[model samples]
Target: MARRSYKTELGCIACEDLSLLGAGKEGWLVDNPNILCAIDTHSVALANRSTILVLGWSDSDGSRLKIRPELSPIEAEYVSAIEWLVFDEIRVIVAGTSCGYMLIYSLRGDLIHKQMVYPGRVIKLRIHGTKKDLIQDTLSGELCVVTPGAIARFDGSDIQNMLLKWFEETHAHFWGLKPKRQGSEDFGNSHEKLPYQLWNVSKYGNCADAAITGIMPPPLIEVQSSQRYYCAVAIGDDAVISAFRLSEDKSRSLVGTILSKVVPATFSTISSLSKMIWRSEQTSPKKPDQKPQSFARAAPLTCLKDHPRKGEKLTLSPSGTLAAITDSLGRILLLDTKALVVVRLWKGYRDASCLFMEMLVNKDIASSSSKYYEPSKSDYCLCLAIHAPRKGIIEIWQMRTGPRLRTIPCAKGSKMLQPSHPFGASMSSSPYVPLEVFLLNGDSGQISVLNRTLDT
Candidate 1:
C-alpha cells in the first residue's frame, strides 16, 4: 500500500446527520434535517427536469420536508421511527409515528399515497424483489405488507408476527410458544403436570438468552434478478452477515452460508485470603459457589456491497461477496465467501465515530498516484470515509497506507462526540459516473460534496 493525500472543502448545509442516501436517474436526496432523524432518498420526475426527493425538517420553518405546492397537504408524521424502501424505480417512504399511521411517498417526493400503516412507530421496512413486488413494513406495533393491488395487515405486533412467520417457514416451530403443558396419569391415578413450555423442541433449546427467548421471525427477504441477495442482520449484541440465493421459481433460499459471530473471552478469579469475624452464635463456614464469568459480545453491521461478477458465491474472494458490516467500534470486516472468514479487517480505531465505504472510479487512482497500481484488484477496494471524533476530524482513506490522507475538521461544538445514535454522521455516493462523495454535517445541517480542487 502507498500513502496518499488530498484536500477538503465545505459543501451544503445538511444541518443534520442524513438518515437516507440514494441516487437515481433524477438526482439525489438527503432527508430529515435534524440530528439522527430518519431520512428518505428517492428520484422524482418533475416536468422536463429530474429532481431527487430530499426529506428533511426545515431549519427556518421547522416543518417536515414535503413536496412544494402541496396537493393533499397531508403532513406526514412518524411517531416512533421511519424507514425508506425503493423498488421498481419507485421510492416507498414509510414513517411509523404516533397514533398508528404510515405516510407513503413516491419517488417524485409526492404524497400521492397514504395509509394508516400502524398505530405506532415503524421500526423496519423491506421490499421483496420477486416478480410479485411485495412491500413488507414492520412497525413498532404491527407487521404489514403493501402490494401493487392490495395491502395485507397482520394482527398483534410486528415482532410477534415475525416470530409466528419464522416458526412456520423455517420449520423452527418452537419460536411461537406460550406457556402450556400436558399432563400424564401417575401410578395412583393422579395427574402429573409438566412444566409449561413455549417454542418448538428443535430451536427452543438452542436459544442463548432471554432476549432471544422471545420469538424473532426472519426478516422480509429479497431475491434480486442476479439469483443472489445480501442479508445483513443485527443480532443480540452481535451482527451477522449472510448471502442467499433464490430458486428458479423465485423461492428465496440460503446461499453460501457465512457466519460472523463475535466470540468474547472470559476471565475468573477467587480470593485466596481468609476472612475473620466475631459472632455470638457461631455458624458453619459456607463455601462460596465457583462459577466462571462470561462477557457478552456485539458488533454493528454498517454497510454491505456485493461483488459485480457471478460464480461461486461462498468463495468470497472469487464470486461476488455478499455484504460488508461496520460497527461503531470502527472495525471493518470483509467477508470472503469461499474462505468463509473475514478476508480483511480494516481497523481504524478500537471504536469508530462514523465510517462509510463505496466503490469509486478505478482510473482516478492511476492519474492521482504513480504507485503503479492496477485498477482491478486494488480498484475493488472501495474508498474508505471515516469520522474520527477523538480528533474532531473527518478523514478520507484513499489507499491502505500511512499518514493522514485527507482530513477535514468539523466546526467546533458539533455533535459528533455523541454516542452512535441515528443520524450522528452518514455519507453517500452519487449515482452518477466518477462517483461523488457527500458528507452530512449533522450539527450544521450542511451537505458537502468532496471534489478535487486544483492549486491556483
Candidate 2:
C-alpha cells in the first residue's frame, strides 16, 4: 500500500515580522494581541515591545489605537503586560508595564486611568466577573495580578463601577444587556463566571524560580445555586502548569488542602495531558512520597509545566474550554480545558505563533439540502493558525485534534518569512466564514490576503 500524505493549503498571510531582523533575533517578532470581548466587533489588543496597539476587526479606516503616548514615559516604564476586560456597562483594555504600573483604557482609545499596580514588572493579569471572594464590593469577578514573586487579587467591583460611570457619563450607552437568566443558550453559557471580581490574593513562583508568564480564570463552573467556583491555571519559568481553586461560597473543595500530584513517566500519553485538569479533584492521591504531585493534561501525558522545556505562552478558546501552549521547543500543545488534557500536539514549528481563527466546519449545512442539516453555530469550528516564521508558512490545525487543515506559505517556494499580524486571537460573535490566507509570489512573502472562500 502507498503511504498517505496530507495536503496543507495556502491561507492568507496577515503581516510581516520586523522583530526577526537579525540572526538569532527571533524573539523580537513576538507581537500578540490579547483579545478581550466580541460583540459588534472583535478586540485584538497586544504589545510590541513597550508599545500597546489595539485593533478592532470592524475598523474600516485602518485606524488602530496606540496606548504608548497616552500612557507615556516609555523610557521609564515599558509595557510588559496587557489584558482586556468587559462588564455589563463597559469594555476596556488593561495594561501593565516594566515599572510596575497598570493602565486602563476605554475601548475607544481613551485613557481612563493609569495607576501603579505593582512595584516591579506586572508579569500576568486577568479579571473575572463572578464573585471569587466572600467579601466583595461588586459582583464583577476579581482582578488577578501576577508579579514575579506573588499574585494579587483585587475587587473587580471597582473597575465595574468605574466602567458603569464611564458609560453613563460618555452618553454612549453601549453596555449591552446580558441574558436575563444565565446559561440560557442552547450550547450552554460556558462563560458564566466572567466579569471577574475580587476576594483573595496569593503569591507564588519565587520558590519555583519562575517568573509568571500567564494566568487564566477557570471557565464557568456552578457548584451551588448562584454559587460558582473557578480553578485557575498558571505556568511560568518551568514546564509545570499550576492549578488553583477559587470560590466565593466557601464550600468544601474537591482539591481542598491537597498539594502536588504525580503523573506517569512515559510517552503515548502526550495527548491526554489536558484531560486530567478538569477531572474531579477528589481522585486518589499518590503514595506518601514521590515526585511533585502533578496535574496531568489528559491522563498519562501529565502536565507540561516541569517537562524540561516548559511552555512560554498560552492561548485559550473563546469558550474557555481549551488552551493552546507554545513551548520553548517550538512545539504547540493543544489542551482541552474542560477535560484538562493534552488533546493534540503539533511539532516541527520554528519560531511559531498561533491564533484561533474561525472555520465553517459544515458547508453543506448552509444549503439545507441534507437531512443532517445543522445550525451554523453548531457547525462553527475553532482552528489554530500556527505561524511558522522561519519557514514563512502558517499551518492551520483543527483544535482538540491534530488535523492539518491547511499549510500556507508566506512566499512562493516558502522563501523569506512573510510577517503576519495576528488576526483576532479570539473568534467573532458574528456569523462564521471560511477564508484562505495566501503569500504573494514576490515581496519575500511580506504580503498576504484572506480570500473570501477556500477550495475544497
**What tens-digit string does per-residue lDDT give for candidate 2 at 125-180?**
65434323345432334566665533455556666665565455445323445333
Against the unseen true structure, what C-alpha lDDT does each candidate score? 0.31, 0.47
Best by lDDT: 2
Location of the lowest summed lDDT over 10 successive residues in candidate 1: 204-213
Residue 326 miss distance in model 1 (angstroms): 3.7
Q: If scored against the real structure, what TM-score would every candidate get?
A: 0.38, 0.54
Error of 2 at 19 (Å): 14
Model 1: per-residue Cα lDDT over 1-456, one tens digit each: 554323333433342323233222121321222212333221111110111234333344232343332222254432343444432223344443333334444333434323343222233333221111124322222123321111223222332332233224323323534422221111111212111111111111111111111111232453434332222222112223332211222221121111111211122111212222333355558644222111111111232333331111011111123223444445555454433355555566433333333343345664565655433433444444555555666665543342344576654333221101111111121222222344444445453445432110
Compared to the true structure, candidate 1 yields what TM-score? 0.38
Give the Å shift of residue 166 in candidate 1. 33
